[model samples]
Target: MKKSPIETVLGILVILVAVSFVHYAATKIDVRPQDGYTVSAVFLKSGGLESGADVRISGIKVGSVTGLKLTDDYAADITMTIRDNVKLPKDTTASVASDGLMGGKFLLLEPGRAKEKLNDGDKITKTKDFKSLEDMIGDVIFLATDSGDK
Candidate 1:
């Protein structure tokens, strides 16, 4: 087929526009972790928590899970990289929580009201294990059956 000059120019323009759009989207949606400081927390279990999971405070993302390790005490040691701007207290608590019933897992950071601030590489001594939906449901059922029997 014979193509005119206008057709060729329009095709080239479309290709250029597509490339520009991809570049723009890539830059805007980059999920690479930014410069941050690291802190460690130990949980009884990872509970499906993986590296790159969100580490949030008050439902807002302030950091991310950078690594996971098993400690000699049989606990899940999680390494979190938090933004340098966010300072946490020494007594802060870290808990593994789900987004909802049967939703994804994330680290929930509950900052403590204390005079001491946590330093980089410091360990978070307090942590709550993740409670699964089945556990809660079983407890509810057990309570209901026991009450009915009584």
Candidate 2:
């Protein structure tokens, strides 16, 4: 079978459209990670908090966790990258939070009222350590049993 000139042109148009659609899709789906300043915070326990986790403020995403390591004091040191526009106060607090009871972990940043802004490579002084579910459960059970014995 022989293809007509109109059919050949239509096939070429379809291929061009397909390629354009693919390029557009690729651009839309490609999320380039933000390049920003790094700040460290130490936590007693990370509670499964890992790198690439979201760093949110007021429930809005403003940054992300970039690195995690152990400190000499046996604590977890978390490095976060905050956007250039978001200037954090020196007294800002970093806490590990979960979306829900069984949800994934994220870093929650609570802004402080201090006049001094945190600079690049500065350490966040106020950090809330991550509390595990097992620890909370144990505490609850202890409280209930103790009350019952009374």
State how far residue 85 of model 1 sits from its true place (Å).
Answer: 0.6
TM-scores, in order shown? 0.79, 0.77
Q: Which stretches of candidate 2 lie over 4 Å from their true place?
A: 1-30, 148-150
| RMSD for each of the candidates | 3.2, 4.5
Candidate 1 regions exceeding 4 Å error are 2-28, 148-150
**Best candidate according to lDDT:** 2
What is the C-alpha lDDT profile of model 2 across 26-105, one tens digit per residue?
88752687788999999998999989999999998889899999999899999999999999999999999999898999
What are the lDDT scores of the predictions, listed in order?
Answer: 0.91, 0.92
Model 2's alpha-carbon lDDT is 0.92
